[model samples]
Target: MTTYFLDRGGRMTLPGNKFHLRVDGAGGRVAIDVTHRDHQGLSSGRRDRATVSRITQRTIIAAVPGDGAPVFRDGARVALFIESDDEHGSEPLTVEVVQQDVGATFRAELARLTPVGNRIELSVRAPDQLSPRALAAFRTAHELLGARTRPHAVADEIDIAIDTTASMAARLTDGSIPALADLIAGVSRAAGCDLRDVRLLGPLADSIAAEPLGTLADRVAAVVGETGVGIGRSTGVAESGNGDDVVLVVTDAPPVERLDTGPGVRHLVLSEEPIAADAPAQTGIVPAHLTATAVTAPTVPDQDAATLRHLVRGLLAALAARA
Candidate 1:
């Protein structure tokens, strides 16, 4: 018999119409109605079910019944079947399974990072594992922000600050292009801004001619492909200057100096990985009298472009909300 392992948030895709519910080895069919009480006497919703499946070791056949297809929703409950090797007088074992919705969990994190009401600013810190998801949620929040500013004249422009250093070569080849492309798409869609308006700062600025904001996105992609230059080690700021409500900083490492802040410059930090716990304290050039918000995206998965896009969308939403 082959043993299958399922963790708290593990998932298994069902091929066709074989099964009605996804199953997990650990938690039996997850339900949506369960709530957990925390230390503060407050109850919060926790994972109801985990979704997963097992494939036969020898044949690689899915262990689900009925054509082996998936038939469950994001939070459906399921069952596990254990077949006995010995046919005669054998005892059968069955267990319950649950499905967990990763998308839902990601949205919840985004909600926590967003602030409510007019002109409120907030910062976010996301674990590297969740950065992509967090960024996608941020983009969603951006649309919501636009909705809030309907009466007031909101600016569609954003100033982007990127780090340029020699080490960026690896990130440029590996992940930065895709990540930036996703960001450009998300910003364009969420803020109703033309792609051409998105500008590249520094030496790269001269290499690519500034075109109509509508064409800026394509130009940026082309530049990324040709030069293969990644956001280097330098740190700069990206601001939607109209209201000074958002500032985005993309860097592989921490800033050498603290950011300068004004009424509207809400600080956000995006990194390829988490800052080391024992790193020395940041000093110098702190933005005077303005609170800063930071968000990080450390690892962009090599095999998951869709997830990466979703993450970028989230970041855009979050920034839009602030605007």
Candidate 2:
């Protein structure tokens, strides 16, 4: 089976069909009604009866009934995201609202969000839009099984931060630095972003050029390879500013100094160390953090290399959604 994993607020393309619900978060009032899609009649599997909700954050899920739960399948794209309705204050988020009526309450609150929030919908099977988390879960599914008719789309304007510290010397021994650099460059290229939107910051390299993935990777390897690891203030990354909706941080050592990520900015982090529990997830949708500390692969020559693959795939999934 394809390994499925992702940050809390991750999103995936629904090739088949997903529920289209309407929620108005205006004046503390809420209403969520399932608006069927064209393929509803064809989705005869238990999957057709599934429900995935996004209380307040984004991560809208899609799946089918399986070992007591719904499994993900291709088709029907779901359109249930969150934005402020401006008239109200905020809304709720729930992945499963079927077992209870919490989804109804979530719909009411979602309807009241501010800044004229988008139409609210869901794909979950349970309730209590308010999970123990502030973010939703995307569980980034890997590549498509076959030809993709629709390209993956996510938030526009993204910012990526890579920490260049002495801790990265370990990666050199494992030949992971170059691999990581290549992944970073590839994501930007695949996103078809303006060269300027792709920002690179580290203890060694710094630039905003729209270079080819290979060239970018080479530059990263040279700078970081020569610089090695050390305890230094990554001022460049800190000052890069929060101009993008999504910011991805890739590093072995997170900056200990000043790094200002705007309040509205969504941050996704991939690290070699463990992340603190308090770091917000889904600052808008789902979990936005990953730790390679406990993750390993027996087949890979080195654990760091395997971890690099996971990080790359996860980042790619998020970037594709944002693109």
Candidate 3:
């Protein structure tokens, strides 16, 4: 059987088979475009569009169609087959999913993919905000996509803020808070920032206020331990981000929508993960953004530096303009 498949399981496509893909935000899921085009003179016999299914040699005789005919979901396991003219026992043509390769997808989207230190660290806020089913999905995905990574180091006295609202710590493991705190501490050390200099603003004011920088091994631990309240109400942290050197916002997107930043506060938003849907952004707060392989990429596939840069570009530009 003549078959072609897109490696990486992250992207699926059919090239010579005439199935072009467009990853668009149609509903709330990643939408794939499947256009059927006729290539004249390629074959004398009529090209009938047969069912798309994955079949093993053992079960070739009685394989059922895999999924939806017209609309196919991303990362789905399926195949396309054109009925062969041969008098064989079963249809001979079988094709596999050709989604883009993970590396190819990254290379196309990123102008440059700098190596991030091994590990992808993320702390979820407002666990209460997500439903049980949604949280489970997030956990599965999170487990798959582990700690942040990059070989580089930072030593600047930049500050980071996390919104640890109700049950947000639930997103991570049992003792993740301490581990996350330690990771931030390592990052702060790389940036050469004292624990006190690395301000950590969060909803738990009482907890943070109770901890002192001297008591912690590093600035990250100090901030993570301390508690502060409100998005715009941090006592020392200016909403406009005035004196703050560098600010990173670790929270889900929506509630932080109206978050204020400073004139020069280059910001990094570690969102809880934008709604996982190809659907248009339904929230009035977030305008629709289409991520296609054709245009400049919205998020680099696997590159952290480029991806982070893309995420904060607009915010940084605006703040820089004011600065």
Q: Pick the candidate with the highest TM-score.
A: 2
The segments of candidate 2 whose C-alpha lies over 4 angstroms from its true place after superposition are 1-159, 195-205, 208-210, 239-246, 255-259, 263-278, 281-313, 317-323
lDDT of 1: 0.32
Mind giving the per-residue lDDT tens digits that candidate 1 earns over 16-124?
A: 1111222232212222211111101111222322222221211111111122112222242233332222223333222222222322121111101111331111121
lDDT tens string, model 2, 179-254?
Answer: 4444444443333222233344544555544244335445555655565555654553534242334565555534
TM-score of each: 0.34, 0.37, 0.28
Please report the TM-score between candidate 1 and the true structure. 0.34
lDDT of 2: 0.34
- Model number with the top lDDT: 2
- TM-score, predicted candidate 3 vs. hidden true structure: 0.28
The 0-to-1 C-alpha lDDT of every candidate, in the order given, reads 0.32, 0.34, 0.28
Which stretches of candidate 1 lie above 4 Å from their native place? Answer: 1-155, 191-196, 201-204, 207-218, 225-241, 244-247, 260-272, 275-313, 321-323
What does candidate 3's lDDT look like per residue over 224-271, in tens digits? 444423434344452434342444444334243443445424333333
